[model samples]
Target: MRPTVTPCEDFNAEEDAKALKKAFKGFGTDEDAVIEIITKRSNEQRREIATVYKTMYGKDLVKDLRSELRGHFEDVIVALMLEPVEFQAKELHRAVSGLGTDELSIVEILGVHDNDEVVAISNAYEGLYQTSLESDIKGDTSGTLKRLLVGLSTGRRDESCDVNEEAAVKDAQALLQAGELLFAGTEESVFNSVLCQRARCQLRLIFDAYNNLVGHPIEKAIKNEFSGTVKDALLQLIECVRDRTSYLATRLHDSMAGIGTDDRTLIRIVVSRSEKDLEDIKEVYYEKYGKSLAERIADEEEVPSDVKKVLMQLLL
Candidate 1:
């Protein structure tokens, strides 16, 4: 995985803070300097800069950025400035708090993270909002999706890399019975238990065994048996476990294709993954869609040039 922002060798938190203050002080903000400092520094460095900026200027860095920047550029900068876990927690809160839930955002976050990451996000959520992530998910979602999100937020997935072939076979049969056979309606618990608790490696084995036993892929069974948000969540889990990069690539494509762009989704994926697997996502996107992610974004005449420039920088 290639990250756009790695640790800078000569990083000085105080100096970066001064530069940011200077950028914000003048009549017109030096957008380029703001972007250069915020996007190029590592997350840890950005956190440090926030602390120093507060100590030096008695002002909140994020608040200052919010005052100075506007539109998608502001969104990208603010998202990048936040600690990763806090950013994710905020995203979770944003997704679930409104009148209608952004189920895809909930799924993207809750489905993809591993046990440790989930635990961190849950903790961060409580810390930020003084409310439990589980409660928020339960309140926002209903039925099977509620159960699935709650299960995912538990952070109880088996973390072992070991694959139990015997257990894989048993789980495969269980999944087949629960999903594909006469016992279809009775499988929600089974789906929750196996999909939520098993390690990704073990799940892969189970999927292979399930395909061999049922004569088709587990995803096919999931699509045939489940519908609506529940099905979407389950399929997201499977796709994330199978190949996270590909899943994210598909999501990025979905955000940009046809109609108006899902700017929130676009910003979330680009900012969140830029320092993780965005390079891989970019490659997969190009391979799958026959156009580079950067190229696609550039083609969108509606997106601000500054925001597009930052996104392209991250992609590169």
Candidate 2:
């Protein structure tokens, strides 16, 4: 079944502020209630609250929290109150601007997201900070990694304009021919034509044909044929067709179940997906790895326990 788009719930920021201020005033701290409502609220509601809180309380909601709370507890609370794109842009900007590139953070964030969201993040980053995210990536990263990040940031890497069965057939044929000849030129042409030019449904069918003829997943073939941005884009298309949740669940399990945890991937996945489908991901994680998502996360001690506990709560 296809996922249905529902309109976001309407929330009055001023109304919520009155309630929140009252709740905060009465108790020592309504930490439990704060977590409950904030985590459950839609991104639209969070944005509304951010504006309303400022007008109602004369302080940024996030700033107020920094003064009121500390540690992992504070991080999750503040995170729940920001717009998703702004949050993502902040994460991306943080990932690269430091001494070393947070390549894993960049990969996990951009890799799991659909192209449209990526473009929104790009636009939001510029609007919020008056700096081009693409330029920051160019300045901060180098080599194949730089190419991959910039290509992703451009938001065109996954735009499929129109579906032509005739075109898909031709593109699939070209891919077969390229694999037959071991010609690098034909490989790129095949990728561009099928992955870039074809519509989503058309490309899905094209990939089916490609796999039937080659007896291997297109992902494996592209991994062998391409490098850098080209490779990332092709693999992204394959994963997009495959179940995204399972792909991410598998990623999370692998990142943590390894010799050492991939803290960035683990944190970003939990932070971003909890509201959308963390429960579904938990089920997928269990089925794929024969262990619950929570268990794997619990096993990874390198991350602070408070952080891990809050992550688990968000999914619940």
Give the candidate number with the greatest TM-score. 1
- Cα error, residue 171 of model 1, in Å, equals 0.5
Indicate the residue-level lDDT of 180 in model 2. Answer: 52
The sequence of per-residue lDDT tens digits that candidate 1 reaches over residues 183-275 is 536568899889989998999999999989968899998888889887887888899888888999999988887888888888889988888
Tens digits of per-residue lDDT for model 2, 1-316: 1111122376566776666666576446666656655655666776687788888779787776666666656766677667778889888888877697776567657756667898898888888778999898889887555666666566565455555666656767788777555645444544554454344567677777777777876777777766665466456546655567777877787677657766656766677776677777888889988888777777778767666666767666
Error of 2 at 256 (Å): 1.7
User: Model 1 off-target regions past 4 Å?
Assistant: 183-186
Which pairs, if any, clash in model 1?
Answer: none
- Could you tell me every candidate's TM-score relative to the true structure? 0.95, 0.75
Report the C-alpha displacement of residue 63, candidate 2, in angstroms: 1.2
Model 1, position 230: C-alpha lDDT score: 79
What candidate 2 gets wrong by more than 4 Å, as runs, is 1-33, 100-108, 111-115, 141-149, 157-165, 176-180, 183-197, 226-237
